[model samples]
Structures are given as structure tokens and as C-alpha cells.
Target: MKNNLRGKIREFLASEDGKVSVKAPLTLGVVTGGIFLAQAIIGPTSATACPCQHDWQCPNPPHICSVGTCIGG
Candidate 1:
């Protein structure tokens, strides 16, 4: 019984064909990486001031938060 099991195991291991699938996620990865990189580069482009005092003082459109106050548009 042991010998038979060993042979079977050997045969299975030595099989010529098996399930080997290759997937291409390059496009997805590129798009995702691009979006993330863009966000990282341009996402924090707020116009607020460095040391803001009030809401109306910071930059407009994209309110940037500085050390202690909100920047204006």
C-alpha cells in the first residue's frame, strides 16, 4: 500500500500539465498608480495660507488648512 501511494504521488508530481494561469493587471495597475500619483502630486494644492486666522482669510475654491487657520481662495 505504501509503495502504491508513493508511485501515485510521484506520478501526480511529475504530471506534464497543470493549471497555471497568468493574468494581466498592468492597465489596471497603471491607471490606479497614475490616479494615486496624481492625487499625491496635486491633491494637496490648497490655496489656504500657512498661518490662517479665520475662514475668510484662506484661499477660495479649495480651502487650505494651515498651521492655525483656514486659508482663503
Candidate 2:
């Protein structure tokens, strides 16, 4: 029974499906790593809304204080 199980394992390892089983995780890891690396390099994409009472309080141009929050630009 032990020998039979060993033979079955060996046969599975030699099959094309076994090759794909090994490669799939490797491919997924590489893709996931690449996405993380890209995000790290690119930095944050959105600006955080800051509390403000007037337009001038918002330092960056084109942004304006509206409803006590900085928005638009």
C-alpha cells in the first residue's frame, strides 16, 4: 500500500497538470509583487480632505474650502 501511494505521487509529479500546479503559485506571487512594487513607486493617488473655514486656508491652488472642508482641485 505504501509503495502504491509513492508510485501515484511520482506519476502525478511527472504529469503536465503537476507542472501547472507548481507554476500557478509562482505566477500569482510575481504578479502580486509587481502590483505592490508599482504602488510603492507611484505613491498615493488621492488627496486627503482637510478641514477649513475659508479658501485661503487651503495652501494648494485651485482647491477651495467648501462646507468646512477643502475640495475641488
Candidate 3:
């Protein structure tokens, strides 16, 4: 029984249908990789400063903590 199952599995793997199944994951991987690479290259659109509790906690000078965010005017 095990040998029969193994033979069927081997036959499936050797078929063109198996090759088609492999392409979907490969395409998805490529697209996912491209998105990551684009993000790495382009970076975030806006700087996201850490939430601030005090004015001193803000990284930039002349910036104040208001509503948990740093604002510079």
C-alpha cells in the first residue's frame, strides 16, 4: 500500500500539473520580494516620531509634546 502511494506521488510530481502548481508560489514570492525591496528603497513617506509624554522627550528642538505627538512650529 505504501509503495503504491509513493509511486502515485512520484507520478504526480513528474507531471506538468505539478510544474503549474510550483509557478503560483514562485510568482507570489517574486511579487512579495519586490514590494519589500521597493519599501526598503523608497522608505516611509513621513517620519513617524515616537509618542511623547513630555516636551523634552521629543527629539527635535523647538518641538513640543501635544496630544501625545511632537509638533514643531
Q: What are the clash counts of all predictions, listed in order?
A: 9, 0, 0
Model 1: runs farther than 4 Å from truth? 1-24, 45-73
Q: Rank the candidates by lDDT, best first.
A: 3, 2, 1
**Candidate 2: which stretches are off by over 4 Å?**
1-14, 47-73
Q: For each candidate, give its TM-score against the true structure.
A: 0.29, 0.41, 0.41
Distance from true location, Cα of 17 in model 2, Å = 2.9
Q: When superposed on Cα atoms, how far off is each prediction in RMSD? A: 10.9, 6.4, 7.5
lDDT of 1 by residue, 1-73 (tens): 9999999866655564311211235556788999999988886655543566665556565775566776445
The alpha-carbon lDDT assigned to residue 55 of candidate 2 equals 80
Better of 1 and 3 by lDDT: 3
Query: Could you give candidate 2's per-residue lDDT for residues 4-71 as a string of tens digits?
Result: 99998888767888667966777899999999999899886554445678887775879888888887
